[model samples]
Target chain A: MSDATEKEGRGVRAVETGLSLLGLFLDSDGPLSAADLALRSGLSKAQVHAYLVSLQRGNMVVRDPQTGRYAIGPFSLELGMSRLLTLDPQITASEEALKVARKLGQSISIAVWGRYGPVVTAVVQANDQLLNSAQPGTVYSVTGTATGRLFAALTNEAEAREIAKLQMAEVTPPRYVGACPPFDEIHEPLETVRRTGVSITYSFPQPGVTAISAPVYNFSDELELAVTMIGPAEEIDISLEGNHVAPLRALAATISRKLGFIGKASGA
Target chain B: MVKSPERQRGVQSVDMAIRLLEIVRKESQPMMLRDIAVSAGITSAQAHTYMSSLKKFGMIEQLGDAGRYALSDATLTFARHVIRNDATLNANINVARSLSAEIQEMVTVDCLVQEQPTVIFAVQGPRTPSLSLRPGTRSRIGNSAAARIFDAWSDTPEMNPNLSRIIRASGYAHAEGTPVPHLASLAAPVFREGALVASISVIGFPDAMAPEPERPVLRALLAAVSSLGGSSA
Candidate 1:
C-alpha cells in the first residue's frame, strides 16, 4: 500500500482495537481486567493496556479503587442518558407513564421496537415491592410478552412472521412447545389487539405477573411506542371493566396526543 | 476514510498508559504490577514505567503498599465534565438558579452516580448560609435529603428500606443537622417515566427549613421538581 494508505490503515486499526476493547464491557456481567479483555479481544495485553490508558484519560472507562477491574465510567452513563433524553417518543411516553403509575399505584414501562425485539426504554415502579418488575434496557421476546406482542401486532406482515419464527425457534421440547402456542393460535389474539389498539396478558412472560399494553401513535398515526402496566397478578385487575384497562388506555392516548396525534379515540 | 497526517501522530507512551488504565478498569479488583503487565502483554519493567507515569497524571492510583493499581479521581472529574454539559441537566440547573433566587437559599440538583448521590449542579442564593457543597460533592445516603431521595427511589440493595419507604410515600425527604452540623435541607425527587432521575434540594440553616413541610422554600422546591417532571422532551 502507499505510504498515506498504510498510515490510514494503521489509524483505523487503532480505533478498531480501542472500540473492540470497549465492546467487551457490553457482554460482561461486571468489571473486566486487562488480562480478561486481552483474552476476549485477541489483542495482545500490551496493545490492550495502551488503549485502556487512553480510554481512562477520556473517562470512557473507570477502574474501581478497591478492585482493579474496570467497568463503564460516568461519561458512558451520561452519553447513554443523553441519547435516551433525545428520543422524543421515550421522553413523552415516560412523562405520561409516570403520571399514570402514580395515579394508579402500579408500575409502568415504555417499550419501543428495538433491534432484538421490544426493548424497554423507561420504567417507573410504584414502590419498592415492584422494584424488580422491569428496568430500562431490558429486551423482551416479541411473542412472549405484552409489549412484544403489541409491537408484533402493529408491525408489517413480513416482520411479524419473522418475529413469530424467531420465538418458535427459541422454544424447547414438549413442555415448552405447548407453552409457546403455534403462530396460527397467537395470530388471532394479535389481530384482536390490533383492532382494539391494546393487548393484555396474564401469567405470560412469567407466572404470577400480569401485563397490559396499549399503543401510542405519532402525528402520522403510526404506532411508535407501547405503554405498559405490569404488576403482581393478584393485585392487577386485567378484566375489560377492571380498574387498570381504562386508565392504561387513557394514558396511551395522552401520550399519543402529546406526540401530535389528533385521532378521535377518546382515552377519557 | 481518508486519514489526515495528524491522525497518524500519537504519543506511544500515552497509548501504553491508556492501555494500562483500560486493563485496570476492566479488572474486578485492584491489580498487582505483575498481573497488569501480563494482561497488557508487556514486561513488568515496561508496565512499571507506564504505571508510574499514569499515577503521576492521577489516571491510576496505587492501592496501599500492596503494589496493586486502580483508577483515580481523574476519571470521575472527566465524567463530571460530560455530565455538566448534558442538556437535561443544564435545563435543571436553570431551574435551580430560579428556585434559589426565589427562596434566597442554596439550591442543588443531585443525580445518582456510581450508586452515590452526587451534586451535579448548585446555585447559591444571596442569603445562603456557610456551607461548602459544590458540583461533584458526594453526600451521605443515610442522612442527607438529596441522597435519601435517590436511595428511596433506587432499587439498589444498599438502600435503607425504612427510609426509602418513607421517601417514596412522601415524595420528598427532609433532614436536619445531617452531613454537616446545624444544617437543614429538604429535597424532592424528579421522576421521568416512573424512575427517579434526580433530586432537587434546598439547603439552609435549621430555622430556614423549620415548621416541618409548610415552609415556602419547600413549596418552591416541590414546584421546581414538578416543572422538571412535567417536561415531555
Candidate 2:
C-alpha cells in the first residue's frame, strides 16, 4: 500500500474511490459527465459528482464542452512517461523485442549485464510452434543462451572480464573458456555486433534455433538494452529471407538516436 | 456526458472557454470569433468576456484582427506542463513513437477508466496501417491490447480479482479485436513501486499480427515498461 494509503487507511477510502473514478476516464473514449460516471463507478451520485468536480479543479480530469464529457488531462500523460523514462533500457528493449518475436514466431528475449552476469529480465515467445520459451527472471548461463552471449559479447572489456570471472566462479567446471566461445573468439561476434552495431546468432542455447540480437539506445547514446529474435531453425530462414537484418539495424539505430545517441562515432 | 454534473452546474463558462481555445488550437491559423464561439457554445457577448480572461491568462489571444483568436505558444507550453504534472498516466511519446517506427504498426498507450477500458493515446507512423486509430480515440475497457494492459496496470493495489489473474498468469494482457475491429495488439502493464501505473502496447492489423506469439510480446513489454516506469518516474 502507498504510505498515503497506509496512513489514511479506511479514512481515505474516498481518495481511493476517487482515484478509481479517475482511472475509469483515463481510457474513456471521451470525457465522462458526473452522472454517467456515478452510474459506472457505483459510487453515490453525490460522491462521484464531488470527486469529478474536485478532479476538474486539479486538472486531472478535463471537461470538454464539445462532447460535454470528461477525459484524461495532460497531467496523466506526464505521469505515464515519467514512469517510462526511469527504466530506459527495459522499455526500449522490450518494445523492440516484441517486434522480433512477432516476426520470427519464436521466443525472443532481452538481457542486461546485471550484478549476476547476464539475466533474462524479459521474454517474448512465439505463440505457436515454439520451444525454449522466454520468461522474466530467467537467468541465462553466462554461456547458456544466445541472448546471454550477445550481451556478454557486447559488454566493454572490463565488464566482460568481470562477468567472465563471476561466471567462472559460479559455474562448476568453469564457463570462463571453452563452454562459451573463447574470450578471443567471442570478440569476433561481439566486434561484428559492435562494429556493425548488430548481433546475430544461429543454433545458440540449443540445436535448431537461430537468433538475432541488437543494442537499444536510450534518450542518450548510452547502451541501455539489447533486443533478440529467437526462432525455430526453419523459421529463421524466413527472417533472413526478408530484409530483416537491415530493418532491425535501422530500428535499433533509430531508438538509439531518439535517446540522444546522435554521435556518429557511436552510430554503430 | 463525461463531465460530471457538478461540472455542468456552473463551470460551462470555464469549459466553453477551454473549448474555444481548443477550436483555435486545431487549426494552423487563428479562427474568427463566430467559429470559436460556435464551437464553444456561447453567445458572442458571453464569449467576449471569456476570451478577454483567456487572453489575459495567456491561453488564447487575438491575432491580426481583434475578433480573431489563435492559440498562443503558451498553450503548448502549458499542455506540456499539464501532461507532466498530471497524476499516474505516463507519457507514451517516445515509447509509442519508437514502437511505431520499429514495429511498422500503430502504437498506442491506453489506460483503464471506471474499470472500463479505452485507448487514451494513439501514435501512428506514416507507414503505420490502421483503420481505427487517432488521437483521443475511444475503445472498450479491458477489451483490446492497449485496454488489457492499461486495465491490468490501473487496477488498484487492493487489486481486482480478474486483473490479478491476468497479471499473475501472463504479466500483461492480450486481445485481437478489441479496441478496434480487426486490429491486433499486445499490451503490458507498467508498474511503479509495485503498484500498476500505466500501460504500453504495440498494435497491428489482422494480416500483420498473428496471435500465437502476441502474449510473449506483451510479457516483454511489461518487463520493459516496469523498467521505464522506474527510471522515467
In model 1 chain A, where is the ten-residue run with the lowest total lDDT?
A: A171-180
Indicate the worst ten consecutive residues by lDDT in candidate 1 chain B.
B2-11
Which candidate has the top score in TM-score?
1
C-alpha RMSD over true interface residues, each candidate: 16.0, 15.1
For residues B101-207, write the lDDT of model 1, one tens digit per residue: 67878788888865668776666554556465655567886668888887766667457688677777777888998657888889988766676677888888888
Q: Quality of candidate 1's docking, in CAPRI categories? A: incorrect
lDDT of 2 by residue, B134-204 (tens): 33344554456655554444425334677657655666556676555766666666656666555677776
Tell me the DockQ of each model, to 2 decimals: 0.02, 0.03
Q: Give a tens-digit lDDT track for model 1, residues A31-74.
A: 78989999999988877776776666656777666777777666
Docking model 2 quality class:
incorrect
Q: Could you say which candidate leads in DockQ? A: 2
Cα deviation of A221 in candidate 2 (Å)? 1.7
TM-score of each prediction = 0.40, 0.36
**Model 2 segments beyond 4 Å from truth?**
A1-96, A143-145, A171-179, A238-243, A250-268, B1-233
